[model samples]
Target: MPQLQAAVKELQEKGIALPDYPDEPGTDAERDARARYDKVKGSAVNPVLREGNSDRRAPASVKNYARNHPQLMGAWTPESKTTVATMGAHDFRSRQKSVVLPADDVLTIKHVAADGTGTVLKDGLKVLQGEVVDGTFMSAAALEAFLAEQVARAKAEDVLFSVHLKATMMKVSDPIIFGHVVRAFFADVYTAYGEQLLAAGLDGTNGIAAVLAGLDGLEDGAAIKAAFDQALADGPRLAMVNSDKGITNLHVPSDVIVDASMPAMIRTSGHIVGTRR
Candidate 1:
């Protein structure tokens, strides 16, 4: 901890400010400095601290204390419309395949397209004996259809629409999924100006704030912005991460992680401590 603290202090002394969030604005030099510093931030220490075990559980002592002194609970009723939506088919869970390594070896993962073109996804991956390796894919068509249905369901049921993903942990896949969610939610806007938005270099994969950040550079930026606003107005009451700041759940990928959020929801009777719309 002291070493980490000293490293942070040294960075600060060099005029590199590390904020709680990654989106803080800075000069090009400061931003470059932050790019390096970010490698040490958040769960970067998990490999050292966790030592391969990431399945988190409270200790017996803490559990005993919690059982004795219970916290305030949120009310739940049979009439509650809260629901857990998931794609039981064509999702990662359904499509996962696993294999246990019988011997230590280096491997490569490749993809073959419909046209018989091959591409290397990963190479030189080392594995040990008895280590379990798994691979999974979620169908984009199925994901989009699922999201579209959920959005319409939320609107129909007059419920708050929100998505929780572990982008920080499931770094590659979750961000891509989050991007699909954003596109699905703002279907009309994307349908109308997707080509232009893509041309302007505003990728939805980085989150809505990123897309919004680059809007000023587009010739039709104002129109695109208005369309986003209109989508929000027309869509179901979206859950706000911070109603005070107009920060929706879709604004940032790291704000709501499943493990962190599920416990909070359980404590609050399925509530995420956020307002609707």
Candidate 2:
């Protein structure tokens, strides 16, 4: 962002007519220019600003009270069906590459296709000495397969299916991933009416709530909604965010964050609320 501003200033000094960048634009053209500039604006402080992992412990008084009046927990048994699903291979964890920079330098991130086509994802990202840079990508095909398997396993085991993701933090990636989950779970619905959904401007990336809301505008909205209802009925029970209101874990990408959901699931004996089986 600083480099872009500097370049703009250099052009202005050469007598080139350019509108001054402002925090708030006063004109239509300036507003348009501001929109364009904002797209390129990003913070390098994201990594540095995040708090590091730390150990959290209960207060001494709380610990003493808990010990004095212990809360009963459900008994664990060999037959317990609790489990977590993950992309065991071809995921970000499996493919991560990292380096400790010995000297300060600028870098570019790019992607090269199997057919030899190249594209730059980011350019002129500057870094300092001793900084650790890591890069990784999850295989989309592997992810789809993993989600499909989990869906099937959920049905076979008669357990509620849910996918917990931290979409708020992983702003760019997790929404796309959540879309994949939506499509996987409703593979039949997508296969049948994918074109219609697209034409209606309903994207799964925004989650089922958005999709359902957009349906009201479609000519065949009722029919499409019926398909969704059938999908829920035929598939395994879904983990509900609110059973009474019919909000499932799949209702929104941001609702069930992994950190929040994981602890809640643990406290509930490996169960999240589910619709009647």
Candidate 3:
């Protein structure tokens, strides 16, 4: 009685139209609609509880149906909860290892020859000649030291130079070692160049001025050498040329050539040296 009452109450609330019992035989469409409405209302009165024992009834019914119809259970078994848990744990551990593994950082240097000579000189020469050096460094300290050395040398030589340093952090497994190697390489190059420059008499004011003038359009080595010699009688005159590509090429005039070439002169003398670490 309660179920019937609830269904009747639900039908009234939903505003479903119901036919009188004395009506003439209903058409097929009318009968179908009435059947659907009755079925829904009937279920609503005693709604199945999916979260309780009532929920288990559906699967049990399905199992019984499969038993009665064995073909439906062919090659089918309920999945084991333990196997699923083990697989989930394995997947979790794999993801953890992936998270713990370190990443790789790559640093590269790109140099373009100013003279289109397919050769790019190192930092010191490039700065003195006012050329471009584009590259990435793994070690910030190494890059900083290299730039500072170049700037200092240019200032000492009375040559105009400028620099811009950009820093960024990248993930790497061994960033410290990578940085140390980079620093060591540049330091060696700087030391080598410094030794070369000291040997040349061109380390002083007069030498730098002569070099600058030579770079400004004075191509005749003898003329520039004479001018430098006259300006600084104390030290011998040295003619230096910095190619548009930033390579410092030094030439000792025949007149100034002693038994041996000056150290500074030899350093800047040939093609720029390009070496990698």
Against the true structure, whose TM-score is highest? 1
Q: Which ten residues in a row have the lowest lDDT in candidate 1?
A: 42-51
Candidate 2 residues lying further than 4 Å off, grouped into runs, are 1-47, 50-72, 199-201, 274-277
TM-score of each: 0.80, 0.77, 0.13
Q: Using lDDT as the measure, what is the rank order of every candidate, best first?
A: 1, 2, 3
Q: Tell me the alpha-carbon RMSD of every candidate.
A: 7.5, 6.0, 36.5
For all candidates, what are the clash counts? 0, 0, 2
Score candidate 3 by lDDT: 0.34
Put down candidate 2 lDDT per residue, 217-249, tens digits, no spaces: 888899999999999999988988878888888
lDDT tens string, model 3, 7-40?
A: 5677889997565432343787767766765544
| lDDT on C-alpha atoms for all candidate structures | 0.83, 0.83, 0.34
Ranking by TM-score: 1, 2, 3
Q: Model 1 segments beyond 4 Å from truth?
A: 1-42, 45-49, 52-57
Minimal lDDT window, size 10, model 3: 162-171
Clash list (residue pairs), candidate 2: none
